[model samples]
Target: MKFDSVIMGGGLAGLVAGISLQQAGKSTAIVSMGQNSLHFFSGSFESMTEPPQRVADLFKDAGIGLHYRQGVRLMPLGTFRESAMSLEDIELFPSEKFARRVLIVNFQGYHDFFSSFLAEGLEKKGMRCRIRLINIPDIDPTHQGPGEMRSVQIARTMDRIWEKVVQEIRLLLKDEDAVILPQVFGLQDISVPGRIRQALPAKVVFVGTMPPSVPGVRTQMLLKKRYQLLGGTYLMGDEAIKAHVHEGVVHSVVTRNLDSHYLEASNFILATGGLFSKGLVSNPFQLYEPVFGLDVEFAEDRNTWYNPAFKEDQPYMGYGVKADDTLHAIIDGKPLENLYAIGSILGATHPELGSGAGLAINSALVAVDQILSEK
Candidate 1:
């Protein structure tokens, strides 16, 4: 049977495409290594805090187009609302409304000001807020995991600290029943693939603003488990060795350190992000492609893309497929007939906007609708 779609990369962008397409009555398969940058940073879902017009103008200045309507109100600091309708009404927010006490944990002292500031404003509205400093290093992938900062000990200490934090919050609410909401990293075992037949703790949901690497790894493990349970397959640790494409179409994918696998798909989506996430980075020699032999539009000089100043955010970090208004990958200046590209893998069209995560998921949602509509 031909698959409805095959998405590469399992992060928010890939998962969004997979989940959305599957829900739309399509069989979708997502291929990924299971690690996502979303866990390394604060997981904040952003809607334009400004008005729609102003938001449009702001994104316009940064070169991103507003494909859908802007959201009116904000969700919690770390959650993503599926659509504008859910965000327009504050009453629809899933989190409890007006909790008296809150916990703020900063392992590296660099919690998102956007979320932190909003939490402070909530405190002024008579919510008692407590901020704790975990003193972990700043967020960086290379310096991740419990071993880096002895985060294992830190995670162990949280159970006791959380008790105190909750007690203080209860007092502030003027009731003993008030409980502390922890902002520190906590552990939960999650189920992952291969061991899917039996329930296992594969994913680790991070409870804090900036989760340490251990939690991030655990999160991926959980997703791998869940993805497999949902009938998805993954080729991990092994890199894509070759793509057998003929006449502008992908035929099959072969991986080195492994064996050959044939895939027949009616449609395909490339969610393999850019250099940072290894979507485009497939080998030690550093060749960038979608693993399916897709033609990529890129800078003449690779150095011209990345921001040189270590302190500055990489101005050239956003690079991938150059898509037309339909979000289809444009190869050799032409859109692939049945292929779509979403997420950070899409090129510099929206670089400075920092809207990649939300836009990627939202755009894929839009693309899935468009794809199904065409069928």
Candidate 2:
């Protein structure tokens, strides 16, 4: 199969680039290995720095809705984390929409959420809130025999007990300002929060739990739907295993599922995530870009790769495939004329800086711009 552009990885970066390219009248295809990184998303876009109007507009064009907010995430462990944007269902910190006294709810056996933890954070942020634990004695919410409860599992079955939860909330809520719930809404239902909120008298807030996040999955589905609506081809359950590069251009990519069937394209994009997602691989000696063998920048000394402190600046987070000003992927110290690297795969994109979503979107757009310009 042939396309105008082929994007490897269907995460936020790859999808954004594919959507932009398709919108620009390019026949684009995204080869992905099952689900994307949004499965780990917190339902909030973390950014230390916000993007410009143009950059923000790209998401609008793609139909992924975001509520830009100047707020922070109230962590359960007692901390205020700054946030830039969030899904409409999520509640940012210090929201005036809620009253002074709030009631936070969690499940009895569900360990993923702790009302006290978040209440502590809220208190530190100068917000008064109460904790309520709703018991689920009839059913086992645990994933694997008395272990921690999974948000994804709970989210799937939440609708069954929706009315029960609402009733409990009403009983527990006594003139409280708002109601905070663990993000166990249905996996694909963004309207669940709205439904609960409408059913209740006060405001309803959804705090992100561990992945696979319902909101994150919903975001992924929304973007994927928009991409399909725009005629972008998405090849799920398949990944680009081999890039047929020659003469400084990527001729095609061959996926493991399609050994001989080449996905030929005029231009290519590499948005596969960094080491965590195996976009860049490493051995004992050195690090290398998995696809196309492009030049990557990372620490040579394994000892200095990480710092002892978890919150401290880890040097390895700054490593990725090296790209030029035009976002073209570099191989053997020369730029690949037709291949560009974007998102977390691009070097100098530090997640700790807290601008990952913005950087990914911006880089995707920039790479799409490069492809458009070169055309």
Best by lDDT: 2
Candidate 1: tens digits of C-alpha lDDT, residues 1-375: 246677667776676566556545677666566457655523333432333453343234322223344332223353334433211112222333334555543444233323466465556556565554433233322355434334434444443344443333333433221222223333332211112212221111123333443344343454455445556555555444555556556555555544645545777777777767766653433336656545555566656656768857664565565776777766667677766777777755544333655565556665776788885
Each model's TM-score?
0.58, 0.89
Score residue 101 of candidate 2 by CA lDDT.
79
- Can you write out model 2's per-residue Cα lDDT over 66-157, one digit (the tens) per residue? 67767766554646566767776767765532357779888878877767777876776567888888876433654435543678777767
**lDDT of candidates 1 onward, in order:** 0.49, 0.78
Worst 10 residues of 2 by lDDT: 347-356
Question: What's the true lDDT of residue 107 in model 2?
Answer: 84
Which segments of model 2 are wrong by more than 4 Å?
Answer: 48-63, 94-100, 125-129, 136-149, 159-161, 349-354
